[model samples]
Target: MSLKSFGAKIFASYIRKKIDKWASQPEATQQKVFRELIEKGKNTKFGQDHDFKNIKTYKDFTQKVPIRDYEELRFYVDKMVAGEVDVLWPGKPLYYAKTSGTTSGAKYIPLTKDSMPAHINAARNAILCYIDETGNAKFVDGKMIFLQGSPEMDEKNGVKLGRLSGIVAHYVPAYLQKNRMPSWKTNCIEDWETKVDAIVEETIHEDMSVISGIPSWVQMYFERLQQKTGKKVGELFPNFNLFIYGGVHYEPYRAKFENLIGRRVASIELYPASEGFFAFQDKQNEKGMLLQLDSGMFYEFIRSDEFFEENPKRLTIGDVEKGVNYVIIVSTNAGLWGYNMGDTIQFTSLKPYRVIVSGRIKHYISAFGEHVIGKEVEEAMQEAMRSTKARISEFTVAPQITPENDELPYHEWFIEFEEEPENMDEFHRILEKTLQEQNSYYFDLIEGKILQPLKITTIPRGGFNHYMKSIGKLGGQFKLARLSNDRKIAEVLEENLRKYNK
Candidate 1:
């Protein structure tokens, strides 16, 4: 092994010891984080307004600080954007991670000097954990690429503003700078398509070992690589063995990715957002990402079913149960207090406190009261593909409450196929059956004739990309929602289908 790989192994071992120390005592670590956040936050404007002085317990904290989403918390964020200091955190944030918002246009989440290390360290620890688990640090010597947004940041009131990935681009560590790919110039390209083409040209001949990005965008990069080299990604980059990804689950895209690479490579799933770096996969054989109990953030959960109810109960780590879906809330050093992250997660292991992101709280289909979530649909797709040997590139589900010919309403699945199934009917059947088995409300609706079985709409190859590009969200942290309550995305995809067929 090279000196770099040898050094990486030693570092990985050191990191693992620290991780194990906290992981083994999840509750105690969390209590420390909770106390630290409260102690520091009490002097801030938000803490003062919320009466943080007398907040002595988790119960007191929850009662005093109601759960608020970005919209509710924006009053203080707007103050920070206007050059206010000590508005949320102890002082002004170092940067603002600009993310696309649904109702609020654009959201600028704070990244404080104290909070930035969590983001950087969590990303680094993800890789080190992988190395420590598998003893595969040789990849450290090869080129690495992370397909992301432009690293060129804009400024708002002297605060740097950019996509979270772009912000992370600035912190790629001194050791990995020599190994990082595409150069800063290529990464600064504004257009994703142009940037990807530039990336393919730059890295085609390099010894790439690790590639990181969202699965969909990275899929585009892989397709471009194949077009240029006429070889599988694994063959083109023989050393490429680790794919680090976040933002979306990888299971649905796994078959298509393995086909493109012509082999399977290990992957690390990360649960990160603009708000904070939350969790990362620590074990290759584990089912979920290990929750970051010691990451300078205090976590709370409300059962997703009761999330909208009046005064829902807030549960901390000790109160959580395995397999039950709960909306994740956090109060962080970044000064988000009792913040509703809007994403739902389910614990897989309570001992070390690991979780799988179930779905977004708002991104579910309950049009017919079935209340189907992203996890259910993703699992069903996995089962259908496994049973039928089909390969799907991408897909989305939306409630079609009305159909032509005055037929009963049903769910519509828009899919782009990598390899069309030999038996489309069988594939559809399996998908519907699996969904029915998992979701009782959906099963009841189908059986009771309130809704028809789900139908599949085949989208042309690259149709999803076309739809995304049409809306100016083709790349860089923009992901297609797996489930929508309305027909907004479905309508555009339907239009794309027509345009493609014509």
Candidate 2:
């Protein structure tokens, strides 16, 4: 191993020990984090407004501070944006992770000096954990490509603001600088397609060992490389061995990615968001990511089924049960308190507190009261792919509540296939059967004749990309929802399909 690799291995060993120490005592570590957050929060403007002075316990906190989404918290955030000091956190945020909002047009999540290390360290430790487990640190010596947003930023009130991925680009550690690909100038290009084309040219001939990005964006880069060289990714970059990704589940894209790379690679799954760096895959063979209890963020959970109730019971880490879907809430050192992250996760291992993201709170198909979530759809798709040997590029689901011929309404699945299945009817049957097995409400709806069997609408090649492009959300942390209650995305797909087929 090179000296850098040797040093990395030693450092990884050290971090593993530290992580193990805390993971073994998850609840106590969390209580310490909670106490620190509360102590630090006592002096902020928000704390005074919310009666944080009298809050002495978790129950007091619950009573003093109600859960708030971005919109609800905007009153404080707006002051921070306008250069107010100590409105949310002490002084101004070090940076603002600007992201598209749900009800509001845009959101600026604070990243303070204290909270920034959690994001950086969690990402770094994920790779270190991989090196430690696999005993392969040579990849650290090779070229590493991170397909991400432009690092360019705009300034407001002395705070740098940009996409979360873009903001993170400015903080790539010194040791990895020489090994990183797609030069700074190339990353700053505002247009994604042009930027990706430039990246293809820059890294096509490099000895790339680690390539990290969301799967959809990385697939685009891979396809461009193949088109240029007419070779599988594995052949072009023989040293490439690790694929790290976050945002969406990897199972649905596994077949297509394997076909593109021409081989399977060791992969790591990360649970990161603009709100916080939540979890990272710690073991090579583990089923779920090890939760970051010592990351300066205290976690709370509300059962997914009862999340809509007026007074849903919010449980702490010690009270949570394995396998139950819960909406993850967080109070972070970044000064976000009682923040609902809008993501649902299920604990897979309570002994070490590992979790897998199950779905989004708002992304589901429940037109007929089925309440099918992203995890179920992705699971059903995985089963169908396995049974039929089909390869899918991308897909989304929307409820078709009105049929022209007086037939019962059904869910419309818009799929873009990498390789079409030979037995279309069988593929459909597998998807339907697997979904029925996963969701009882959907099965009851079909059995009661309230809804018909789901239908598939094949999107032409590049159609989903075109749809995303048409809406100006083509790349860079943008991912299509697995399912929607309404037909907004479905109609766009239909429109793009017509344009593509012509």
Candidate 3:
């Protein structure tokens, strides 16, 4: 082995020890993390504004700082954007990670000096931990290609704004950048289609070992690669073994990905957003990610079901129970305090604090008393696909609660298919059966005749993509919400279908 590769392995060993050490004392590490954040930022403007110095305990801290959403926190973030020092954090943030709003306006979340390493190191350790657990590190010697966002960042009052992945790209280790696929220029292309073309041209024959991205965008890249190479991805890059994914659930796209690659590759799931790198898969046999307890972020959980309660119970690490859905609230080094990041998670295990991404707090269908989460919908799609052997390109579900005239209220699905099943009725039957089995409320509604069966509409080719482009949310960091208890997204899908039919 080369000296450089040997050096990489040695450094990875050090990070693995750090991960394992924290795993042994999950709660203690979490407490230390919380205390450290308070200690470090207690003198900052936000800290002083919230009386952080007087806050002696978690209970005291929560009592002092109320939970806030992005809009509520915007005043402080805007001041930071306007070159105000010590407004949120102690100083100006290094960059603002802009989120691609699905149906709403964009948000600029901050990335600070202290917060940057928490994000980068967590990702680095995720891979190192995977290698430690599985004894699979061949990928480390080859390319680690991540389908990242544009490197082009817009500056507002001396603050840089770009997608979190693009911001992350700037922090790629010096060793990996030598083998990271596609030039910075190609990744900076704003057009998704154009970018895919350039990426295909750039990395068609490079020695790729690992690939990472949101499933939809990466699928586009894989499809383009197949068309160009006239071979399965596995055939083109035999060493390709690891896939690290976040942003959306991978179950619905599982079969399609497997088919494209010609085989199943080992995978890891991550729970990262513009807020911070919250968690990543740490165990090969485990279902959930080991939460990052020492990542300079303090996590609080509010029962997901009771998120809108007049004064919802805020639970810390010690109070969180397993198997319950909770909306994640974060206090970060980037100056966010008791902020609701909007993502909902459920603890699959408590001893080591492993969690699964249940759904977005905003993305669920419960209009007819059927509280179907993103995970459930993804599972139903996966089950139906498995049973009927159909594959979908992309899909979204919405509650059609206020039906016009004689139509009964029901859930509606707008789907784009790579290959449609020959028997659509069978596909629906299997999907509906799985959903009913998964969600008791929906089953009860159907049995009581209070709601009709679910509705499925086949979107025309490129219809969803057309809608995305029309709304200026065409690619990178844009994840079409999988479920909503509203008709806004469903209506747009219907409109796109109509336009395509014409």
Across 255-316, the per-residue lDDT of candidate 1 in tens digits comes to 99999999999999998899999999999998999899888899999999999999899999
Clashes of each: 0, 0, 0
Prediction 3 TM-score vs. true:
0.96
For candidate 1, give the lDDT: 0.93
Error of 3 at 357 (Å): 0.8
Runs of candidate 2 with Cα error greater than 4 angstroms are none
> How big is the positional error of residue 60 in model 1, measured in Å on the Cα after superposition?
1.4
Q: What number of backbone clashes does candidate 1 have, counting pairs of residues 3 or more apart or in separate chains?
A: 0
Cα shift from native, residue 489, model 1 (Å): 0.4
Question: Candidate 2 vs candidate 3: which has greater lDDT?
Answer: 2
How high is each candidate's TM-score?
0.99, 0.99, 0.96
Which 10-residue span in candidate 2 carries the lowest summed lDDT? 492-501
